[model samples]
Target: MSNLEIITESRFTTVFIIKMLYAFMCGAHLDSIINEIRELEKPSKNYKRMKPATKFIKQPLEGLWHKHYEQVGLKSMAMNIKQQMGLNNKQQKIFNNTFFKEFCDIFNNSEIPQDKRIEALGYLCSGKQYIDRINDGKLTGEWIIYHHCNGKNYYLNVGNHSDGDDALAQEIREIALFEFPFFKGSLPIFD
Candidate 1:
């Protein structure tokens, strides 16, 4: 998990504790509040006794998880293809399958609405470094590009697909569309 995810989720933890503390200060049930405080102060047990129902539920599913560890569904299975990409005269190496899944997970978990989530993904992926790399070159965009490789980040106009070598450019365009759909609006670098 990223540090930002941890921080955002932790806001709830802070709010819960503060609410409990506020009730204590307001003198709402002195004995119950003191007992609650004591309960929290006590260290949690290192081991938990497994419930019988949990065992019964999981018994039949034991080996099922192992067979599907790398893939959860059809969409994920489709992304499992291995591919390499390069730009700026160097190889860029990030597993597109893994990266796409990560973005999908983030978008799925986020509170943002589904259609708007794509815009959020675009903004997140199009950080200054990616934009700057493209601005320094012949390419143009406010859009962000994630090569199947990580280091080969670049910027290109939305719908402009003349990257990579002759054979690889089409494949690169396909991967770019899969990963960087945020370039709905990309301005040229020169006028």
Candidate 2:
């Protein structure tokens, strides 16, 4: 097997290894999750928000869909798409750098089935359809039920939004607040 395949197969083990390395670098014990948390909490000016366009673009259906794929943890599936479509290195890098790590993290946390995860990722990566689904109010509530191109329903929930900066923006932001944790603590202003 290729190195990448081996690495992918041993994700849990790799996570453990990464934790061990982190602990060793910081002179800490392996059994202490709190220690890791404490170390992470130390203020660092290097932190920066992921750019929305770089992370979640507003145009080109493919770009948007890819972001959704990353959000839901389906890089392998996304990679398959890249291979099948003969994506160039630049495109591959975009998916690899931006969403691959995030996908791994989400996969580790979520208990959703693989097929369902793939379906959701597909919806997310399909930019035009994803926007349509969101704008059509199909992505609201505690769970999102997306109707795929083939007419099958796939269920998942990013969260709900209740307010925004304006009537419409506030409503959109409210939904975002619930569905996306990054927006949870943010203030919603209507003008």
Candidate 3:
């Protein structure tokens, strides 16, 4: 039996005291017992004990969150997307619950830069056909872009798509080349 098992088995008040005293008298063995006690007192690292869903449930979704982000910038972006996509009340509600909530969660997790937040939201919403509605032979709005790659349809809000302005495309190319100096060839033309 282990030293901890022996220590715990002694229930009587006087007996427990005597056992501990005997362990301390043994010097080297006493250190192990003390170490075991310390280990038992530490907080658990077991993820099974954690409820990740509880965190999502408790996330601030209304009132203060809306008022705050609205005052900042996300609200304006959401409104722009809503107007451009012609979302009705019901559709707007669904959009808020899904994409907007996920966007807020990203910000809540860390102080992400505005550009990074936009890029993340664009990436998150990409590859979904529902947001890929076309208008006047072009993908409408700043929120969605439909691009064809390898016979598959992908949507992106950022990056060099055909609909993106020349300045924006050049900026993306420059950023890419600056970030990865080894890439000598041009980026894939997302037509």
Candidate 4:
């Protein structure tokens, strides 16, 4: 075996004889050589550090949804949607749950960057029917207005075909332009 190859020996035996000799020739202490070997054996900081798979956090909007839709009975986007789509409490819950899950799936994926998560979610929500079986193709005409603030996604409104697609699209643009004017991601086209 090469002098650099580690030999299987008793615990007390010298593991690095070649290293020791080299150290001795260089006027370095055995302890210093051992420390050098230990350092070499230690894993690098880069190797030890691993990025978390998901940094996507879902803020609960159930209370907000209830407050905005149930308490006031105002003619907001969600209300319009609820009325037009005739979504009961159970159907609403299912929509919220499924949408949240799909959001999590996209955001938690480490492959997608923080800036792009919202865009990806927009694409999915616009195209995919998450709770199709229950909502009778609800997502087909869904409009979700969201604000990405400090890495947190705040879903502001949920509209549908009943609310008028142009109105919903314009609402999103106005919110992005006026409310979150400093937003990073370009406005995602839902057409």
In candidate 1, what are the lDDT values of residues 1-191, reduced to their tens digit?
63322322221122223433443464333333223222223424541211111111132111111100111233322222111112322333343455476578768875777778777676445442233333332222111111211322222111112322232233333343444454222211111
Over 4 Å off in model 4, which ranges?
1-86, 127-191
Comparing 1 with 4 on lDDT, the higher-scoring candidate is 4
Worst-scoring 10-residue span by lDDT in model 4: 62-71
TM per candidate comes to 0.20, 0.18, 0.21, 0.24
Question: What digit string (tens of lDDT, one per residue) describes model 2 on residues 1-191?
Answer: 64322422321223334433443464433323222122223423442211111111231111111101111224423443344334478866875665666556546556888887776666545543344333432221111111112222111112112321133232233343343344333222211
Among all windows of ten consecutive residues in candidate 3, which has the lowest summed lDDT? 61-70
List RMSD in Å for every model shown.
27.3, 21.4, 27.3, 28.4
Full-model lDDT for every candidate: 0.30, 0.31, 0.34, 0.38
Number of backbone collisions per candidate: 5, 19, 0, 0
lDDT winner between candidates 3 and 4: 4
Q: Look at candidate 1 and tell me the lDDT of residue 137.
A: 29
Residues 1-191, candidate 4: write the lDDT tens digits.
53123311111112124323543564444443333223233434442111111221323221111001111122332433444334588877876877788889998999888779888876555434322322432212222334434544434334433655455445444444443445434334321
Clashing pairs in model 1, backbone N/Cα/C closer than 3 A? 92-149, 93-149, 93-150, 94-149, 94-150
Order by lDDT, highest first: 4, 3, 2, 1
Error of 1 at 42 (Å): 66
Candidate 2 Cα misplacement greater than 4 A, ranges: 1-87, 111-116, 124-191
